[model samples]
Target chain A: GAGVSQSPSNKVTEKGKDVELRCDPISGHTALYWYRQSLGQGLEFLIYFQGNSAPDKSGLPSDRFSAERTGGSVSTLTIQRTQQEDSAVYLCASSPRQYQETQYFGPGTRLLVL
Target chain B: GESVGLHLPTLSVQEGDNSIINCAYSNSASDYFIWYKQESGKGPQFIIDIRSNMDKRQGQRVTVLLNKTVKHLSLQIAATQPGDSAVYFCAETAPLNAGNMLTFGGGTRLMVKP
Candidate 1:
């Protein structure tokens, strides 16, 4: 079975630039999540989407970060005016259901803001 | 703030030995726990998960144990192999939350010595 997939495995951008990371969730998955992994740190929850419900944006670091799940299948995480602190791996995951379900992850997009 | 954390940052064991990774969570309301393994250049892969109702769950060569009373979780790998060397993370989620967002702990780097 095809797993969750992400695009732009690696991205390098200048400070203050905008970047977009894409994720393709597995077929039939209704829940998608975005997370960030910093060096020597744990996975930080970023945003979440379940079906067509309002996405949870509480985990996002700041106003510059936003994500949209289109048609309940694909998601795009956008960071506007990126900062050096945003240099990290952006990971995506999806699950069959929203509650207490095993999540499949996609190889993250490593973003580097210089 | 409540969060999941690992006691040890790294562990090394001989090949074929049994390895156990421990995690401590602060949210007593958490009812689901999961373990994930990540290689150097890859995203995290689900290893196993255990519900608060169960104390343990086993998968192929991995076992996940959850202790709701103490807010603790552990992942044990039987006959650990070099291929198992990677960073292991434990995550928890409170099913009551609508988002069911997972809070991940600092990863434990497992090294299997040949």
Candidate 2:
């Protein structure tokens, strides 16, 4: 079976620009999550979607960061007015269920805000 | 704010040797813990998980130990191989959260000497 996957493995963008990263979860996964990893730092929670429930956006760093999951499968993380501080690896993960389950991860999209 | 941290930033071990990575978390309220392995230019792949109720859990060649009293977590790999060399991260999640938005610890880079 195919694992989770993301598009545009690498992206270099100017500051103040907007970028959208896409994620395709594994088949039969009902929960998806987005995370950010800065150099020499831990992974930071961004947002997550569970089935048809309203996505949890509390982990998003700022209003400029937003994510949307369509049809309970694919998810897109959009960064508006990107800043140099937003430069990092954007990782996506998915789980078969919501609790007590393992999350499979994608290869990730590396975004560099220049 | 409470966060997870690794005691060592890097570890080097010979192939076929056992490897141990340690992590400390600040929040006692966290109920779920997970370990992930990430290679360069890749997302984190789940290794093992242990709930607050359990002290230890094992999967394949990996074992995860959790000590709630000291707020510590550790991942041990038996017969470490070159393929096991990667950054390992420990993540925590509280019970109240509806979605699986985990708080990750700074990763420990494992270098296997073949």
Candidate 3:
């Protein structure tokens, strides 16, 4: 792809339902990151992936929130038992070769847990 | 902990005036910094970046200044315009072994009034 790509630009789900958001990073990018942006709030770090490593999952908000990257290309973020507080925009980014290198962002997926 | 996407303190500037956005980073080891601009419903776009080795860097109508001594960073926009109204984010980069990863600061919103 020409840039980082995220899917399902907008979503509205019932409370307690599970939702999965997808991300397709730029080709050959080695670092991928996930962030949550709430209304009028700062972007919150959610998770990070470096190549095929264990990933830096320190930012995951809870047990119900999880993410995974396959073959170092595509990724998915799953939120189980969605809550109203979970409504926000999920942003994904990826950098070429290194982590601190420039990270290109995606359009993001906006989720609304009703 | 390093983060990005600020709660967004806002700065309003009249058209043809200049706007300055400020940030403070927590990591002393972070030497590389980049500024991003995000419009409503859009992902952030890279504005400018400065290396720790340099105190300043300039681009078309935009400049980024780094004060490592104070752990502060600022973005200056010359001749502000209504199109410049957007949220600005400052990010710091840390060397992580073979890669460098960015930790973002809270964002600041710039409103250019015509």
Candidate 4:
């Protein structure tokens, strides 16, 4: 079966620019999540989407960070006015359903804000 | 204010040897815990999970042990092989208004010597 997939495996941008990272969950997954990982650090939760409910933006660090999942399938994470501190690997994961413990992940999109 | 952390940042073991990775989490309210394996340039891949009600769970050559009393979690691999070499992370699910979000620990890098 096809696993989760992400686009633009690597991205380099200048500070103050905006970038979008894309994620495609498995065929039937109903839940998607985005996280950020700094070098040699743990993953920091960004946002989550389940079914048609409002996305969870609690983990988002600031208003500049936003995400959208359309048709309950694909998700895009956008960081506006990126800062050097925002340089990290953006990862996406998905589960078969809400509250499911196991999450399948995609190869992350590494973002470097210079 | 809750956080998850690992005692060791790196571990080296010979092939065929058993490996143990330890993690500590501060959120007692967490009910579900998971372990993930990630290689360079890749996102995390789920290994196994255990609920707070269970003290231990096993899958294939891997075992996850949780000690709620001490808020400790450990992943043990029996007869580990070179393929097991990677960064291992322990994550706990924190309840959110929208659902459960994972809080990950700083990963422990495992180097397997053939």
Q: DockQ: which candidate is best?
A: 1
Candidate 1 iRMSD, 1 decimal: 1.0
**Candidate order, TM-score descending:** 1, 4, 2, 3
lDDT-superior candidate, 3 or 4: 4
Clashes of each: 0, 0, 8, 0
DockQ of each: 0.85, 0.79, 0.49, 0.74
Candidate 1 per-residue lDDT over residues B1-114, each given as its tens digit: 888999999999999999999999999999988899999979999988988889989999998888878888999999999999999999999956558788999999999999
How much does candidate 1 score in TM-score? Answer: 0.97
True contacts kept of 1: 0.88
RMSD per model, one decimal? 1.0, 1.4, 2.4, 1.3
Weakest 10 consecutive residues of candidate 4 chain B by summed lDDT: B93-102
How would you encode candidate 4's per-residue C-alpha lDDT over A1-114 as one tens digit per residue? 599999899999999999999999999888898999999888998899997788989889999999999999999999999999999999999988867357788999999999
**Please, what are the lDDT tens digits per residue for candidate 1 over residues A79-109?**
9999999999999999998999988999999
Candidate 1 regions with alpha-carbon error over 4 angstroms: B96-98
* Candidates ranked by DockQ: 1, 2, 4, 3
Q: How high is each candidate's TM-score?
A: 0.97, 0.94, 0.91, 0.96
Q: Model 3, B5-80: lDDT tens per residue? A: 3333889889999888888887788878889899999887889988899999999999998888978888989999
Residue-by-residue lDDT tens digits, candidate 2, B1-114: 878999999999999999999999998889999999998877888899999899999999999999999999999999999999899999998766658678889899999999
